[model samples]
Target: MDDFDMLGAPQGSAGNGIGADEDPAAAFLAQQESEIAGIENDEGFSILDSGEVPSSLIQDPDDANSRKQEVEWKEKAKLELEEWHTRQNEQLEKTKVNNRAAEEAMVSELDENSPGTEWERVARLCDFNPKSSKQAKDVSRMRSVLISLKQAPLVR
Candidate 1:
């Protein structure tokens, strides 16, 4: 009995009967082809090219546009921030100028109030209105004179 008959298959029936080879590798290949053919004939079965991308993997046009818009928004925001910082610096400079002017004005007023004569300053310190009173009769002037002589009034 042939080897094929011992396996309960007729000779050359182990693979496709069309020029089938006795080699096991060829038989496996033929079996695979037949199985694939059967699958293709079944309902809702189709073969696809391995090189082609699936629909889910393809990039959508709307997604690309949204990404571009996001980049533009970030750029706009950065520009606005820079402009705001520039305006703030300008305002700070103006404030500094105003403050410096006010300080100078105060210094000038203090200089104007300071007496040109030391005697007049001493009279003011002794509570006499040097600019409004008669110098000869002023009691503060006498006190100023005594202080200048190092004989300041004794406090009792």
Candidate 2:
């Protein structure tokens, strides 16, 4: 009937209260026992003694189906994202090819070492209309700079 024994304390020296009614160990055991008794009387309290679970605790069938559908939707969305990325990469590659072809065409049309004056060659390569007032000024400035560079003496 000792409170310490109810708490599974060792039956020997320690189990016996040190001759005091106000022992802390005894008080703790009394509290635990009262709580356990209260829970046992509750109608909703239960112990799953058997290995099998009761149907009440099982998940609803609709929830399981919804989860399965959600997983499938996520998988479909992931595949769509991957396909979009692949298409974007293909378009980027096509653009690069087109740019390279355009550059090659321009270079073939006019070689940098072709026989012409420096101004003529530069103006033609840049597609500059020397007739335009703004372009004429730019071309004149470029011609002067080029002429000065060409006439400058080699410093050795």
lDDT of 2 by residue, 69-123 (tens): 9999999999999999999999999999999999998887666565334555444
Q: In model 2, which range of ten residues has the least summed lDDT?
A: 120-129
Q: What is the C-alpha lDDT of each candidate?
A: 0.69, 0.70
Cα deviation of 64 in candidate 2 (Å)? 2.0
Residue 2's C-alpha lDDT in candidate 1? 62
lDDT of 1 at 30: 99
- Against the true structure, candidate 1 has what lDDT? 0.69
My TM-score estimates for the predictions, one after another, are 0.37, 0.38
Per-residue accuracy of model 1 over 97-127 as CA lDDT, tens digit each: 9999999987775576543444444444565
TM-score of 2: 0.38
Worst 10 residues of 1 by lDDT: 115-124
